[model samples]
Target: MTTSTPSTPSTMRAIASYRGLPVDDPDSLQDIEVPVPQLRPRDVLVRVRAVSVNPVDAKVRSGLAPTDEPRILGFDAAGVVEAVGPEVTTLAAGDEVWYAGDITRPGTNAEFHAVDERIVARKPVSLNWAEAAAMPLTTITAWETLFDRFALTADSTGTLLALGAAGGVGSILIQLAMELTGVRVLASAGRPESQAWVRQLGADGVVDHHDLVASAGEVASDGVDFLFSPHSKGNIEAFARIVRPFGHITAIDEPEGLDLLPLKSKSIAWHWELMFTRTTYQTADMAEQGKLLETVAGLVDDKRIRTTLTKTLPDFSAAGLREAHRLVESGRTTGKVVVTR
Candidate 1:
């Protein structure tokens, strides 16, 4: 038998199951030895060095959620490529890389993960495994929401309001909106710490989401040109109340229901930013994900965009995974939480 390297396992440990189940059931996570996946023509096998948890991971863990068998539960990751498929030309073995793996495949929680070349990108040279691990999901989601939904141009100039600017996507979203866009950026954070968090990210103004209509009106009487929400329901009317005529509102949260009619009077457009949709749908621009991630990595490398890792667990373990879930579920984290190799 071949010996396993310290960083590379011949058969690695992963949180998985023979049957689907919920993470809360205690039977949710099982340590098992599984063969490292062989790369397909367009695939890369990464020796996962670190990972971060997202809400979707927990949701997918429970049999309550639908997915193929023996599913792995992670999304954000930073790793070292140990092997590559023949057709892969962009990356080779030992490249440091990061990615938000497709929801269609096993996740990065494993010691070794096989992913599509189009979905992976070179990791930022400046960050350690844990810090780099904090980025992929939130960065991709935030970048797509601002540039894609808003169609924000380089020259676009207007006051932009970001709702819920303390969470994972919101934190990075605030930073990019302030640094990259010509728009004068404002953000909402209900508590003092949350308010201060956005300010450190360079928000020019802050409002409370508790009563966005009134709170935002104080900042922009005629309403801001853009309203971005990373929070949940009850903000649609507030968004409608404070968005300029013909403006745009983008939200990552899955609001139970929204009254689109409220935006009708102002001719305002509403955009739903779901980062998984493109991969889930196999869109024409699916490959754009790799390109965008590469761009984000360049920014991180230059310190233009910062790594958002707020918490780090020393190793990848079920207990560690559960703690990450608890923090996310609390909805109080300021940035990302990561678990490193």
Candidate 2:
């Protein structure tokens, strides 16, 4: 329980949830007034400047049951800190920050939102509100998978395959692996434009996603050392084949009927990363997320890496937010879609 409500408004405008309607329905996402969230001991109130629409936003909105509560839907955000809770130490009012918020909490689709300081970090100085907003969720997933789960080092050498390389997470994963590690990534993108997009992001090679194993084989004859599987449902067996014996795979998608039997025989280790894991369970090392973000921020400022923002809506208008959602739902979008202030 923390005090300090004077600078905060009693209510804020936000985009409300779909009540289980399809994206085409104009009523699916609408403008609504919701009370500003209260802060916890370690919470910081962010005056959200921009938010990016992720696939989960569409999935959650479409699956959401009818509710009297306004379920705001967004995760990635970049904004200024308006207020801090009593126990907040790392951030303060007026400090700009960015974070992909916890899925368990009411989201960042609002004008104001509250998040734990441990998971929030200084916004990259090089990127604007929209560009900065485009990262966070994907960046966290990529950073955690490559550095934390796989324990990759700068001296590490091997061929890494990024399946679905044009999507948000894959887009960043390609850049991070190329910039931070000795391993070269063969980015898998089905479309020519997508292949070009990933290559522009510093990918060492690009493979067609339609024939993942065959395309990847052309690049890594002995199979790859690491596979970044953003969508692993129907491709588990293919992944096991592409990965060398005792190789590693990192997955972010939740696919039904997932079978990992193929990997068991090859001793391929599977690592799953969810950016919300830290904030949802309040892990002891949660602040490590902030530190990593800070590190990436430096890389961004140094121009060694870049933001994946490709589409931008001018403002927080409901129509714009819905359009962003529709674009993401279309499944053809490359990089990230952000609605900015």
Q: Indicate the residue-level lDDT of 88 in model 1.
A: 82
lDDT of 1 by residue, 173-283 (tens): 888887788998888898898888888888888988887788888887878998887664766666777888999888777766666788899999888888888778978
Regions of candidate 1 where Cα sits further than 4 Å from its true position: 1-10, 17-25, 62-68
Candidates in order: C-alpha RMSD to true structure? 2.9, 1.4
User: What is each predicted model's overall lDDT from 0 to 1?
Assistant: 0.81, 0.90
Q: What lDDT score is found at residue 240 in candidate 1?
A: 72
The segments of candidate 2 whose C-alpha lies over 4 angstroms from its true place after superposition are: 1-7
Alpha-carbon deviation at 155 in model 1, angstroms: 0.7
Task: List TM-score per model, in order.
Answer: 0.92, 0.97
User: Per model, how many backbone clashes are there?
Assistant: 3, 0
Writing each residue's lDDT as its tens digit, candidate 2 over 125-228 gives: 88999999999989999999899888998999988888888999989998899899999878999988999999899998888889887888888889998998
Candidate 1's displacement at residue 108, Å, is 1.1
Report the Cα lDDT for residue 18, model 2.
Answer: 45
